[model samples]
Target: MADKSLSVYKYMCKYVVGTENHIKTIRLMNTFTDNLSSNNIKVTITSGSFGEGLQMVGSDLDIMLVDTTIDVHDEIKSIVFNPTQTNFALMTEDIKAGFAMLRFISSPNPAIRKICEKFKGSNYLSNALFKKSFLSELCPVLHGPCISDKSGHLDFAHCLHSKYWVTSASQWTMRSNNSWPNESTKQMIIKYGVLFVPIGSKGSNNEDLEWRMSFSVGEKFLIYTFSHTQLLVMHS
Candidate 1:
């Protein structure tokens, strides 16, 4: 019985669970594809289940386009003026957790300014306007934070890249947890920072101006650390 169970486990690991080398190869190929498809102003990242090196049957393709030209800062003082990049300060006060309002600070680009609306004498980036600009006849469906095709096979999330971590999720890095995700992993996640998806807090008055914070990059890293057994359990 023990021998049979061991053989079953080995079979599962090789076929269902996938070997370590197989997973690594998939990840490397995805990375190469992303690099080839990305540009200086925008970075294309393969996200969701496939990005984590797990490709299930009938899973849709998740793509994240991180706009590098825009910068999101936690505070106005922390923002260093860059002639080429547009800047926005994160407004988390009175907002729900995992969401923030982006107040337009400065922008060299007119196209960015065109999407912003002035509220109470301050220019604010409008989530509605931002998402609207991406809309057309081809991509009409809005799936939460992502824009999807008519078939829904592909999901593209246009995100603003931010170097600084949001204040609301800052506690996660310092939280007392001994078993999983060591200090090194935490530091690496922090260094990767965060991305702001063009979405809002539900039922909030400032929803139209709010953008939900995304930790997909960190999440991908964490998922990569999972053992074959753990991945098998999750897959199951």
Candidate 2:
């Protein structure tokens, strides 16, 4: 039994588990995909299980389309006026954790102004309306925060990029840990900031105005730091 277990582990490490070269190839493929898919307004990011170089069967290709034209900031003062991009302030007060309301600050883009609505004397972006606008003849199904094709092979999450990190995750940065995720990795995670998916907390009153915070970029970074043995263990 012990010999069989050892053989299985060795096989997994040699074949099933992805090596650093495999990860590099996956990253290169992702970069190529991104280059082909990305445009002036939005940047494409490959995500999910495959993004981590774990090629599991029957897994959908997860993609995040980050709107470069839109900018989200945690605080009003942190926002810098850009003549070309739409700006939104992330409002977290009284809202559920991992979710926030995007207050429409200013936008030179006419299309953005058309989707925004006034609520309680404040301009706010409607998550529903924003998502609705993305629906078309080809991709009509709304699967959670992602827009999926009829075949369900692909999931595209339309999201906004924020330059500033959220205040809610501040504790994570200060958390003491002897091993795993060094200070440099933490800084890199913070530097990338976060993405806002076009979804809200279920049963929340501000569902239409709220966007869920996504730490996928940082999560991917952490996954890349995993060793071959760690990957094999995770796969098992």
Candidate 3:
């Protein structure tokens, strides 16, 4: 057999989105949303090809859905965190408190800090809700809390949606930590610190106080992590 052209890969990378299967994946996730309505699961199409620039080539689509019905309080109780030790100073008390709650749930370890940062806006509501949100929506498209199984070594989600054989993966924002940062990234964060965006005041009582948030900084860095090839590979 002669060499099969890279044209195939190029073609796949080119029109990855709006493809038949991708459309079907959208429909399927929407269907999952509809079907699970009784279960009170709000399935938002999160952190996939469209969001992460990782749209790939096949009916075997990657879909992330946030199960809003889940209450993550117990998980937070188990996690060990000390906000006073965090290097995330230079922000407002309110902003700091929000990040502290996020750090409590998401960016506990310095090593995975970069990873955790990338998915921050996904849980932007978490910033507003603080401790109530946890790290459910943020993180990468493929990162989310794993739903347990009684069967074999499937640490991920698998299902047959419209006979398309959809394979899914997830990571929760909740994390267990016993330590803090001691690396270059930590140094940089401490020096530069988290930023805040002016989104206006909080309420009638506090019109003078503008609402500024630095939550998306993590996701911004996460977006940067995707190199050209990685973006193509992810989309593929």
In lDDT terms, how accurate is model 1?
0.84
TM-score of each: 0.90, 0.91, 0.24
What C-alpha lDDT do the candidate models reach, one value each? 0.84, 0.85, 0.32
What is the C-alpha lDDT profile of model 3 across 72-128, one tens digit per residue? 221233444344232221212343232222222333335323322223333211222
Give the lowest summed-lDDT range of ten residues in model 3.
160-169
Off by over 4 Å in 2: 10-20
What order do candidates take by TM-score, descending? 2, 1, 3
Q: Could you give candidate 2's per-residue lDDT for residues 73-135 as a string of tens digits? A: 886774567878898988888999999888888888778867777878998888888888899
Residue 230 CA error for candidate 2 (Å)? 0.7
Selected candidate, larger lDDT, 1 vs 3: 1
Error (Å) of candidate 3 at residue 23 is 27
TM-score: model 2 vs. ground truth: 0.91
Give the clash count for each candidate: 0, 0, 14
TM-score of 1: 0.90
CA lDDT, candidate 2, residue 46: 92
Residue-level error in angstroms, candidate 3, position 15: 6.4
What is the C-alpha lDDT profile of model 1 across 1-236, one tens digit per residue? 99998887777667565667777787898999999999998999999878888665678999999999998888677446787889888888887888888888888888888899887788899988898788778788888888899999989999997787777887887776684787788788899889999899888887888899899999988888888778877775
